[model samples]
Target: MTRQVRRLAERTPPQRERYADLLRAVAITAVVIGHWLAIYVTRDGRGFQGGSILQVASWTRPLTWLFQVMPLFFLVGGFANAASLTSHLRRGGNAMGWVLGRTARLLRPTTMLLGGLAAAALTARGLGAEPALIGVAVWLASIPLWFLVAYVAVMVLTPPMYALHRRAGLAVPIILTVLVGGGDLARLVLNVPYAGQANFLLAWLAVHQLGFAWQDGRLPSRRSVALPMAAAGFAALVLLTVVGPYPVSMVGFGGERVRNTSPPTLALLALAVTQTGIALWMRGPGNRWLRRLGPWTVVVAINSMIMTLFLWHMTAVVIGVMLLYGTAVMPDAMPGSALWLLLRVPWLACLALVLALLVTLFGGFERRAGRWAASVGTVKGVWPTALTIAGVGAVLAGLLALALAGPGHHGPTGLPVRVLVAYFGGVAALGFVRRRYSRPARIAGR
Candidate 1:
């Protein structure tokens, strides 16, 4: 591990933005830890059930403000995607190839996750495990896919979005913000059905657009931009939540009439703006600190398999629950009890150990898949780009469907056949795209 880290550090380009990698690593880490912390699992005489700490403790809802690091992902994603897409285009690459390259890293590991979950669910059912238990387990384990759905959608739109970014500059995010606000108004005030749903893309896109600005030097790491942006966003957040109708929690809580996160409202967008400011404010110092070999090495290590880490972290929790709680190896306590609070320490440690093992086993897939995708020659032509886009859309839809259905929603297989068909069909489409269009160069003297 030490040798691998050292080699990665040596190979890293000097001009690369170490801070973006650091932020990505930090965002995914926070998400993993936050999730592990939020989970509230209980075993009754009947069976095991899982829930969030936020359900029992209202105080923790505000803390979600700190843990809602997902915006950071889109923010960093925008920055990275802008850089990546631009470089690819500059080298005469087609949009289809660029999109394929971008999604390969995400989909490859996702395939592993879905396959593993399906197999596990089937095996559990064969052992006569209750379908309800399987459903909950599958649901909890597949939580990360929800984010992938949105992130993948945003990524597929990057080509046109980046082109718009080049043309419109800061106005893009501003317009998006206004659209998000309008969506919230229509939903909350007018009680318009499905109006808020649009913000799911608009709000995140607004945040992501900020990334393009940041990448191109339009959004600078200056107090002039950072302070006012932070203040306005913070002020808006307060007004939206306290003075207005929006929920205070940035994440969705059970039984909330209006969640800041679930379709996303102005409050969530405000949070994103504030976080963007904070990220910009810290960019200067953070990048300076990341210049050190030690910190950079740590960031590189975390990011190398970051997706795998995020995708499998919840599975680790499920495994720990079965091993420790299912068999009564670990005693249970009331959700917010003092004992439960104290028990969190050991619970976290156990989950971390299991997560580390899972990562060790699955992280290689991310790296290997990435290399294979990179090796495929870029395909050109309008049809290829259109088909690739369709392929990506199918994958996103399938993932969203599976996530909504839950792993065991259909029964013991842990996969709905139709949903799996859509997802795998998309994967197959991408595979077909690669083979049909990609032309590997002949070896010398062959």
Candidate 2:
């Protein structure tokens, strides 16, 4: 593994933005570790239950500013998608084809995760696990999908958004940001129902548009730009949370009256801007640091299976909770208590071990999926493009349904009929398209 990483590092192009890769690696790592730390598990008479540390330690809410790194993911995603799409277009690829290729990488691994969780949920049911417990368990496991719902949508929109970026430059994000602000205002001040939902796309699209700027060199890594941008963003963030009715916690927990994240308020966008500025500020030194073989090797390795690690980290937590808390191997130290704090080291270590094993087991799927995606040729005509769009829409719709309605919502099979059909049908459609268009693999004789 080390040798492979070293080789990858050695072969990396000098023009590549290593800092962007580093930021992606850092963002996903932060999310995994942050989630593990935030989840507070305790065994109850009914079964094991989990809650967020933020609920118990209100002081910890403020720390979410540092830990809520989803903005960074979308930001980096925008950068990556813009780059990938441009390369594809330059190679004379169609927009739909590029969308299909990019989304295939994401959807492939996601399909595996949902399938695995469903099978596990069914097995637990056969063993007489309570339905409610199963539902909660599946819900917790699928929490990562909530972010994917937004990401996949934004990803699918990238081709069009990038086109807009080319024409409008910074004005695109500015308009999106204004719309996000209006959404927040409607939801908060007017108490309008579901109006803030627009920010789900607008806010993320806004952050993503910034990535386009960075990619095109419209947003530079200069002290003058970075300093004021960061300062103004930070100021807005403080003001919104402290005085403007938004919660201090950037991450949403159960039962929060107002969250910066769920619908994504202006406060969250402020964090995105703040993070964007900070990322730009670090680009100079960070890229230079990544030039070192050792650092670059580590970043390469992490980025290779970053999605797998993110998707399955919560499952590792669930497994650890079941094995330890279920069997009374883990002590019931109340969250925020001294003993709980002291036990965090071992707790984290145990979760890490479980996560490592899960990653080792499932990471191959991601690698193979990427290989498959790479092998497929671009779609040429209207029919194939339509097929690709329909397939992607079905997949996203199914994923959103599962995320909203737990996989265990229907009990024994662990998935609703429509959800299973929609998801698998989409995967099958994509598979068919790939097989039809795939370039033949090199053979021994060839």
In lDDT terms, which candidate is top? Answer: 1
Instruction: Please give, for residues 1-446, the per-residue lDDT of candidate 2 as tens digits.
Output: 66876888899999899999999999999999999889898887866766899988998999999999999999899999999888766665667667767777888778888889889988998899888777777788878877888899899999899999999999999999999989989988999988888888899999999998999889888989988899999999999989988999998888898888879999999999999999998888998898888899999999888889999988988888877774444689889999888877877899999989988888878877776665554665667666777888888888778767853457666666677888888888877776675332222113
Displacement of the residue 52 alpha carbon in candidate 1, Å: 1.5
> How much does candidate 2 score in TM-score?
0.95
Candidate 1 is scored at a TM of 0.95
**Candidate 1, residue 371: how far the Cα is off, in Å:** 1.9
**lDDT by residue for model 1 (1-446), tens:** 76887799878998999999999999999999999889888888877776788888888888888899999999999999999888766665666677787788789999999989989999999998888778778878888988988899899899899999999999999999899889988988999888878888998898899999999999998989998998898899889887889887887867888888888888888898888889889888998998889999999899889999999999999998988884444688888788888888888999999999999999999988877765554677778767787788789889888767754457666667776888888988887888788542221113
> Candidate 2, 207: how far from true, in Å?
0.6
State every prediction's TM-score relative to the real structure: 0.95, 0.95
Model 1: residues with Cα > 4 Å off, grouped in runs = 326-329, 406-408, 439-446
Models, CA RMSD each: 2.5, 2.9
- State in Å the error of residue 68, model 2: 0.3
